[model samples]
Target chain A: MLGYTITQWLFGILSFLAIMFALMVVFTRNPVNSVLYLVLTFFCIAGHYLLLNAQFLAVVHIVVYAGAIMVLFLFIIMLMNLNADTEPRKHIVTRVIAGVVGGVLLFVVVGALKGAEQLQIVQGGASQIGLVKNLGKVLFSEFLFPFEIASILLLAALVGAIMIGKRDTNINLK
Target chain B: MTAFIIYKAIMCAAVFLLSLGVAAYATLWERKFAAFLQDRKGPSRAGPGGIFQPLADGVKMFMKEEIIPNVSNRSLFIIGPCLFMVTAVMTSVVIPWAKPMMVGGHMYDLQITDINIGTIYLLGVVSIGVYGIMIGGWASNNKFALLGAVRASSQMISYEIAMGIALIALIISSGGSLSLKDIIEGQDKGFANIVWQPLGFLIFFICALAETNRAPFDLPECETELVGGYHTEYSSMKLGLFLFAEYINMFISSAIMAGFYFGGYNFPFSSELYASLGLQEGDWLISLIGFGAYFTKIVLFICLFMWVRWTLPRFRYDQLMNLGWKTLLPLSLFNLALTVVVEYFRGNIHF
Candidate 1:
């Protein structure tokens, strides 16, 4: 029970941390700083996943998002020479439009929250569904089609990416 | 409860101190190893057989002045080395050092925690390890540092996939458990994993060499190209820390390789040794003996690491990338497929 209480406290602290880092990801002016903040946010979310007894999900999230993707983000930001404090200023009209879009999104989110359903808390062994064996079984059996489709979509995206990333060299005229 | 807590604390201190101590000596060993390879005298003035060279090196590092460049981000410059050292230290946790020992009739494990998903945890932390170099190099704001950082990040990212895939093959071959203790114990029961997963071991070893930034794969900090690489702007103990973390990383990686492929603390004649002595397995006596064998294996690995370092020249960056992505990655996947096919043929694999 003491350990359980500590876990709850940790979850609360980590949720707050995740939100703060998420905000920092947007607010940071430096692209590298923003990417680092985003990585911190990913780690905080990984902590939340761990708190939910989803160890595999937490680790995979770290490995893929924080580890690989954010490192690439840092790499790209560095290679493009984007670290200088030289962000172009937005036009007044553009800022106003962005503000309006943000306001609308916030309102929509709040309105949806007004009709939120009651929380369904399952008893013992519910969290065990996050274990690798159980998760894999569910993915293969119940969610097989969706899983296959998602992978196929990812494969198509990968191929499209290669095509996009390829340099267009002009051929010599014979 | 107090005893358990005390034991855990002691184990933590022991593992930490052991890693630092071994890292210190590994530096001396590396020097001596290089000298032996090159047929020259190496640090004979420090102590007998250069045994005290690490201590002298430590003192020298401490005495050096700490420097912060005017353009460098001060806070991040400091955090970079500290983060690198912390990640390097943390990786030793999942490795089971020896068999469980008996203390006052309570069985005490030499390992910190035998958690499930240990290898995944290692992968995750290792992925995060790139941040230290990235932050340090970026904070330096120097072109060489930046290039080095970029190289380090890309190199780690490329190698980690192959490393993880190779590990997955091992996991499949070793009954699909993600725990190191299970892997090692299973290995101890039979021959080492090198028997079944030789190709996997080779792939893992190469990836490990790349991962630890050892020679041939030392492109990130190659002196000729990048001028000390990511630590170009770093000075004093901060520099010491980055260097320390590398050696510490080498030690941990070697230890892990031993555990996963070399039967951990188990020797081939360990059971026979026990039988001759009329002692049971899993006893503290056996545990101590196993620890002795484990230490020997670790020393041999450290030697191997140093030997390879002195023997091979550093790889060019593009060549490193090609080896990682084209060669090792596919080879690991093929090994995984071969494992699956064999397991299916052996009638152990199920859908």
Candidate 2:
């Protein structure tokens, strides 16, 4: 047997699960099922974050992706009443394009992994970086500019959403 | 390591049993409390003052017939209630029941696990809780159930934003530690968070009501409109699980409110009493007294929940959404700013 601590074994299992569920998200015929599978994939990713001792990241991942975003996706699908019977079939040309796009994405990922291998892998030591206090200090001090920029970007997106959602007063008056 | 694992296992079992037991009694109490409000006796036949009512109810639920619609998705349909119950039980793990107790030479925390991001963990678990109602309602393949599920998910999502903001305000005033233990200790040293963050507490309280699907905000299971709502197609223990999870959620949220705002497990004159008794810190007896105080606070909160449930009428769906987004959200933001201002002036927080 290969030498592996419980943590390593758990990491391997979670990685496998993440990939499997990601595949399930694509393969599932029903839209609701697809969304639920994606949620499982998110949970697996969150598990990976926990294994890294990024406790804040892990919980936030669950809260945002698995909890909020996926629920919205499921909500939309449920509202639409989409099912396997109602799923529109793709043309052969469209399927071919999708396949090609997926292949290119996989290639890019593999290339990234190859590059990542050259970088030093910090393994097997508990780091305080994941704790909220350290994370807040880092974000506030060193990464202050990027963090504020991100907040501004989010505010802009919020304004855009509200504008899109608003009705035309002129049309309503008429 | 072995001893630690064994201790943790025991803690898990204890917490699991405690939640379930509390949830069971909560059901009986809800009925009896409702009876008290309406000026009638409730379930008096089971035992003296209906003490065995929950037990009887449990037996009835277990003995009843369970049905799964032929058209429904079997797996998701079955998984729904189990998921609901699991998440309900999972929340109690992070709650510090009392001060750490000294047993033999070791200090053992009453909490199951004291993760650093305890508050966010609760939020995450609560956010995931909507899935149980959603899946159950959808998997029923019935129109009423589907409508219920839709209402549930939307309501939970809307209220959660305000709830998180309210929590952020409280966390700011209570020294920015996400751990419940630290929050409680901060209260022990000074005033409970409620004194400082009353607005935040009110917002959090309202949001908790909405989050738990308690009445006045229980649109998800509104019977007059959508007959039986989310559990329309459920039968026997499957339905029981959904109801049970609701009570457990109420209990856990009560405990959280106690910890976050009400100085959990800390009573006035506690130190003086301990000193007079010749008991040192971390004494088991001291922890037990603190637990009794904490339990009293939680029970009071639970009764308050019941009181509101009986008194107030449910809001219209539009009204609920408007209150959550238009009212609570802005109020929570204002509270956050107010808390920040106060903390800075007090020199507790540095810009």
Candidate 3:
């Protein structure tokens, strides 16, 4: 049998990639670069989704987060015409403090995960129940209210985007 | 055990190399296809119907003088295309090229990885892909690039809803499994889900086109108006990477559509075909042949993408938004409702 060591190694590499990219996203000086790095970070997170047996969630994460939202972020960054010089420079002390805070947060999260050793990691591989059909049934039945609310939230966001994006002259006419 | 490890390693390398090679040649194929449609000879001089064209193009891109625009954000400019290409290539991991094979007393699926959430993983990767264009355009510090990025982002976001809704309809019909393998297996019984979910297929196809930023939906890099759109300030291999990612995306998108709706590696009368060929059940060779069939379908879809690119005109920004929100979105929602009603009446509703 192929040993679990290979899988563990693969997971280790992917997790490291994800964490590094996430850090890069914040640390990058250019906002546009930061956005790109964030996209990388999201892709790595999707990799973790694959490792977790959540294929549908992984694809949806890419579609929604990387494909759609990141585009919006990029659009905003570009529209703002931000440059390296335009970006506010943080003082060295501020940067150090931020780094320390981030390090502490990371340590806490890792420590919590380690402390939960008795917690079983469910091997929820693809089954008949996890299909889109099952998900839809749950969404439309047990979670219908929340699903509807989410739709409403999306609608509100859409309308707000339209209103905010409208030309000043058009708004004045209204 | 060492042999098995070696074989798996070789397979991984092969798939990775093959994808990159195919992505390179896809550019050549697109050019040739576009030229054929336009009634012109496409790159005939670059070695026997332009087989060496991709290599030549690669060399040219590599050798080109790299330019960093004076006012541009250098770091982001570099990051954009790298992010784009990485996301484009990463989507292939979960794709089942063939059924699992027994080698050295171990059964292994031909896919690189068999993640349960394979389809959603693809969507997530694609969503992140937009950042490449956005960041590239933003870093350029050009008004035109900024405009292009804005148009692209909004367009992608609007169309994504329609796409998601269509997929939801398919999921309801298919009984909730998001793994591509399971989705393929679900269709193995008889008719493909596309037969039952025709409207859903249509909605998904159109959205797929929009998602890939193909012709009519390719407002992000609309050359005539936005001066090459998001990549206007890009130069050298960095620009080439962005363009390369687009084509790879096209290939990947087509592969996905084929997998989800076209029955993947399963062909009509495939079982009979296997029997006629004297292939035993679970034969690795037969499965590989099935993989070839699936790939052929994917290639056809890719060709269709190029065909559409040559056929259609770019959509106006307002028209694009309208199509996404007013038309495709409503149509997909209607289709979803229809699917639910039909499935409920048929007693196919598992819940």
Give fnat of each prediction, in order.
Answer: 0.88, 0.92, 0.96
How well does candidate 1 score on lDDT at residue A14?
A: 100
Residue A89 lDDT, candidate 3, scale 0-100: 76
| Candidate 3, B177-221: lDDT as tens digits | 768888887877788889989999988889888877888688766
Give Cα-based local distance difference scores for all models. Answer: 0.88, 0.90, 0.80
B1-351, model 1: which lDDT tens digit per residue?
999889889989999999999999899888887787889888888877777899999999999998899988788888889989999998988888888887777788889998788999999889989999988998897989988888887898899999999999898888888999999999777779888899999999999898899988987667765687899999889999999999999989989999998999998977888899987645778888888888889889888888888888888888999999999999999999998898788675898
- Model 3 chain A worst lDDT window (10 residues): A124-133
Error of 3 at B329 (Å): 0.9
Misplaced by over 4 Å in model 1 are A1-4, A123-126, A169-174, B280-282
What is the TM-score (0 to 1) of candidate 1?
Answer: 0.94
Cα deviation at B248, candidate 3, in Å, is 1.0
lDDT of 2 by residue, B177-280 (tens): 99988899888866899999999999999999999999899876677775868899999999999988999999999999999999999877777888999999
Q: What is the lDDT of candidate 2?
A: 0.90
Error of 2 at B209 (Å): 0.6
